[model samples]
Target chain A: MSFKDSYDIIVVGGGPAGCMAAYAAAKENVSVLLLEKDRDIGSPVRCAEAVGKDGLEKILEDNINPRWIAATIKKFQFVAPDGTVIFPQVPMTGYVLHRKLFDFDLGLLAANSGAKIVTKAYVNYLIFENDRISGVHVRINGVQHIIKSNIIIGADGVESRVGRWAGIDTTVHMKDMETCAQMTLANLPLDDDTCVFYFSQKRFPGGYGWVFPKGNKTANVGLGISGDRARSDSASARLESFVHDHFPDASILNKTVGGVPCANRLPKISSEGILLVGDAALQANPISGGGIATGMTAGKIAGNIAASAIKSDNISADFLKRYEKEWDTACGNAQKRYYRLKEGIRKLSDEQLNKTAHVLKDIPQKKQTLVKIFQTALIKQPGLLVDIMKTLNPFS
Target chain B: MILLHDNKCDFCGTCVGVCPENCIDLGEAELNIDHQICTMCYKCVWICPVEALFAEKVK
Candidate 1:
């Protein structure tokens, strides 16, 4: 069969957002193409692989695929420096995932919906015609292939080049970027149904550390320190030392280091015949740096919008703005609030965290919530009053 | 050029891991250094486990 040089929609990237976008676009029976630069769809994984059960339930179906899940969590613990642990008694569903399987399955779902999948395709630029995106110029198998498309979706992630090529401001401010380093550890016994968070200014200023258990004996231990404060310091080294000190007997099996965009949201997400989803649009959860569910949500919305626009023959920026509106209404407001909370949390010091932990320890575990955690953090730095008020306001 | 001595290497693999251009390659036994696509972020130098690999800042 001759390779078609055009598609109804070309979705760049095959991550959570890209996969969902392609799946939605193809489900409409439109000829779609999903491109992934990685040899394997989800190899060389990132993210801490923790997602709330309620959040997953809304997005995925019952009889959830076990291949994607490493374990199910039941408890949450946040420890401050000096090893003061505050057990927040909120019941939530958490999952440690096998990201490679999860991402690959999502891509396959898109393909099953009729989206053509291609790997090792590097998209270099967007093709423009008369102030509209016509398609993308990609190099696959060392040969440049130009695939024309009516609508383009950017699911390219933090290291995205598509948003820039499409003329969308994709720069991540150093202060807003979380420098992260993670390791899969063995021989560390942990609560199989509990995830632990450690906050220490010296170790992770402007960010925090996490231990998401894969089983009773294995876990993904990692930390994300705010890039701004770490300008002269090494966040990754600090993380490694902390891990060494905390888990002296554990062996590091694999390591992944990357940056997460902590920005609230891109002011604009769509342009003429083009749209951005997931990390490409900075849709990551502000405090946690988790975006699989959020990105997939945006992808589904973008696909629907693209299909509607194609049917109406109106794929202009103004027409595509509906995606921005719908996505914001669905999840943007919460992300914006979380961004503010993240700033507050980033500014906290080890002393402050310890103090907050001390206070939370006194409070009944059953009474603890994220709001109380923020309130306690703000107790020392009352200058963040406005933020506290905004946080207290449930309307946000 | 990038060279990470096994004895001195911390095995952090930060050299290969942080390379934006995917220049450095990590192997089980030794670090694979690629000079072709090195953007020279020097992030690896800061992250090396045993201070084995260092980058000469380009002038």
Candidate 2:
């Protein structure tokens, strides 16, 4: 009813990352409080909704509920600027989630795990005690209240202020930030459960576009462009025009806009009693701007570590650093590599994208894993070939 | 007014490629349609992975 004045762990932001952190921490029987700025559990959906099955399975077990999924992804298609398509063969892929439902469900799971959920509550600052994080200062309905907690987790999204409040340098450079816009349209004919990706400098310079089919002739269509190439153009306006031109007959459904943090993990993510997860930590997939799984994965580790540190009666920076190490080993390293690959690919021209598609199209559909496609792109640029060679080394 | 999130349309032409009336066109970040000739079937909305376009019932 009033502000939660105390808890074992306080997680800021009720997104995927925050939910996971609350769930995991509560699982350890810790008193956890999750604060969300939005009034509803899941409002203002900001995701493109396409996640690979294998990638998700790596983070979650098989028994996940089916209500969270909108559709199961079957095939993956890659397209060039001129529309040269390359069908990549892979095992079972992931799904396109109904984020509103999925996010709400995740919060409920955390609630069931004995975590407190507070909506429309904005965390204004970290409550510091003796130069260490002891709790959070939150504003709810114009009332400022301090919540004392042993640990604080920052999951407040791409341009997160929580990390900054915790004294973490969370600024994302323009080049590493992906500007995204999307819409849900109806009456558009598309293959059920197939996600299509497009690469072109004109449409999405230094990034790509995607169409994740959502059955019944509807889809979540969107594009991601790096901030460096965005200039002064309104990315949302651009997407509207594209839709009017391409699907003149498709009826409009809804629109959403947001930014995706394409940056790699921060140099440091732990400070005294604070831990960062999800987009707040720049844990999004570098190449695709997707973060559901990565955020969830890091959340699990961060929550566990926070509870353990509190139990051990130590909240020093050195003790909290284990959260970063565990998270980095689990998925941070792969994200860093993907970021490098994304940078390399960003340097390519539309013509290069077309040529790469041409070269890769020759590969049999059965052998079109992402690695092979990357290999094909590198073959055209000998210098890039060397970089690819270096990147290919597992140790690197 | 019905709108599209340009940043989200991947331009896979799923909307246009699949539009029976061929309403959707591909160019830059603009997912445009010939509004005068458009039908607003919303087939594109259902097919979009990024939810780039939406059909609004102008009451």
Candidate 3:
């Protein structure tokens, strides 16, 4: 009914990463506390709410929730700057999710694993002693509480204060950050199940605009521009103008605007008694800025590692180094490749992007696969071939 | 302390969500920062979409 004197692990932030961390740690019979600043588990969702099917399966395994799926899509369409529409039939398939339900369900799983789930708890400061983080000072329902913990998992997200408080360099450069805006629109004449992505330096600068179908008559329309490349308008303004120009008759149901860090992963993620997971550690895909899958994976690794470290009676970063190694083996290498590819693509001129679209368009549909698409995208950079090989054909 | 450049800000609330001090506040029509509570951490400055917030140097 009340707070405990101490916990084996404390996970700050109850997003997918936090929930997964709590669940994994609790499974090992460790006392884990999951704190969320928001009154509800999930509200005012900031994501565009889509995840690749293969990546999602790897993270969730057999624990897929049918209630959380809004749409399963296969068709892929890319729009270029000069109004060039290219349908590159690739092997990738994905699902647009109902994020609210998904986030709440993940937290429920964590609670079921015996982690103490506390909502409306805003962590104002880390309780540090002798250069080590031991716990946090959280305000729950206007009542301040000091909860002690041996290890802290920082899953707080892109603008995370947890990592910074623990003496990690959590600063993200402007070019590495994506200024994003999204609107859920209903009553639109969206006929296709295909997700459309519009790329134009003139419109979005370093990123692209996307429309993921939620159902027959509705879709989540959004865009993310490189923060440093943005000349004047905010992401929300650009998205509003884009929607007005493109989907004139569509009516908006909800809106959200925020930042998503698509930068390179930090060299160091764990410290004396703290582990930074998800966007806090910059695990989001550099190219797509989609992090749900990666965050979930990182949470599982960090949680399990924290539990093991507690049992070992050594809370040093040296003991938790396995978390970084495991993550690199899982998806870190691929993320690095994506970062390089993003940098390579950023230099491509608008005329060159249009040309690439035209070149891809002329290719036969039957011959167009994700491998070939990457080949086209990386024609200039031959070094990416190995990464593409590993990603497309992991076994070899 | 930190200063909020009103003209550059779009009031996206990204700064509000990340501020550990709860120094930054977003209203329906205005951006407010409580200077008393602000510790000059600069989390908001590094993450602001429009470069709205910045650290005020102490002389």
Candidate 4:
């Protein structure tokens, strides 16, 4: 396909957030162009490929295809630093996804909605008109082009350049960034319907390890350490030791490394003519570092807002504040609560974790709900009691 | 000075995100660092998962 001189809206990055934004905007009959830096929509999977079943269903509705799911998770276990396991009986369902396929499918949806998709199109910088964000300077196939747009959506992942270009403070502190490494391993025997998390300050300082099953004796084994704590050893080295100690006979299939922003959302996510979604806006859960569902949510909101802003021809930062207000009401508020809880959880020592596990072990498995577990874990930090209640409040 | 080992670098952009200077550009297949702009804070070097980045003294 050839290039266009201008578009009604330009969506950067082809991840879930980007595609969803394109899909929503295009569905509104606006001219949308989606740009992806990678050669493919989802070739290099950066995430652990897990999402809540309800969240996925809410976005895709009846279009939830089985092809994108690798494993259906029904339960999860938490391993304390002392090796004590506590399985909370929370009523939730999740899926280990084929992110490559899932992301590609979302892209297809956007294309079907009349959005133009372009891969390997690197956006070098943003174009400003009269000191207001106007468009972008993109380079594709060694040739550069300036594409003007009424609005720009920055759906780029953790390494978001668009936000920085627009003068938003997208910098993550060393203590808030999670330096991660993961390997897909085969022949590793694990429960197909269960996910496992290991917490150990000694092993994974300021972070944790996880084993997410992909099915049939295969899993994604990985861990993330806070940037401040990763100075002593690389994340790859830590994962290597973890894999060796846990699944000695498993064969490594693939290796991936990246960073996850575990901090709260940016103070500003929208400028005059640009809106930031996904990791660009730091929408990932602070405690769990999950962004797929939240990214999609942000994308849908941004896309819809972009369409309205274009139709009304009022693309000022003041008009775009609607996106920020709506986002905070929808998911950003919950993320703020999660960030508070994460801060509380980070202060727990290994001994405290072990003690919490021991205390939870005595309760009947059926009565060990997630709320109960958290209440016991944060018993010492009375201040966090209100945060726990607010974080887990279903009504709010 | 900051040095990046091509053999070890995966272009995953982990270092790009934490660079306070925002001087690193992650291309499709290669990672580039603008040394003139880099302050040698070593934040990227420390956060690199693969140990692909290094800090060296100028000879």
Model 3 per-residue lDDT tens digits across residues A1-396: 577968999999898999999999999998999988777787658898888888887788867888998998878777889988877665777889999999999999999989999887878789988878889998888888999997999998775777777888776777888888889999887754788889899889889899989986899999988867764777777888999999998989998778888887888889889998988888988888888988899999999999999988999989888898998888788888778777877777788888887888888877666567667867887887777765662211
Reference-based lDDT, each prediction: 0.77, 0.76, 0.82, 0.90
Instruction: For model 4, state the Cα shift of residue A96 in Å.
Output: 0.8
- Across A152-212, the per-residue lDDT of candidate 1 in tens digits comes to 9999877666776787776666567777778899999788888898888877877788999
Best by TM-score: 4
DockQ of each: 0.11, 0.02, 0.23, 0.83
Docking class of 2: incorrect
Cα-based lDDT at residue A54, candidate 1:
68
Give the true-contact fraction for every prediction, in order.
0.03, 0.00, 0.18, 0.75
Q: Give lDDT tens digits, candidate 2, residues A12-95.
A: 989888998999999999889999887888776888876766656666676467877877887788889998999876565678
| Sequence-dependent TM-score of model 4 | 0.98
Cα lDDT of model 1 by residue, B1-59, tens digit = 55566676533333442345545543323456677766666655554434566665454
How far does residue A261 in candidate 4 sit from its true spot (Å)? 0.6
How far out, in Å, is residue A183 in model 2?
Answer: 0.2
Off by over 4 Å in 1: A61-63, A380-396, B1-59
Query: Candidate 1 DockQ score?
Result: 0.11
Q: Candidate 3, after superposition: displacement of residue A201 in Å?
A: 0.6
TM-score, chain A, candidate 1: 0.95
lDDT of the structure predicted as candidate 2: 0.76
True contacts kept of 4: 0.75
How does chain B score by TM in each prediction?
Answer: 0.68, 0.74, 0.86, 0.92
The superposed Cα distance between candidate 1 and the true structure at residue A111, in angstroms, equals: 0.4
lDDT of 4 by residue, B1-59 (tens): 89999999988887877888899998778888899999999999999999999988998
Q: What is the lDDT of residue A123 in candidate 1?
A: 79
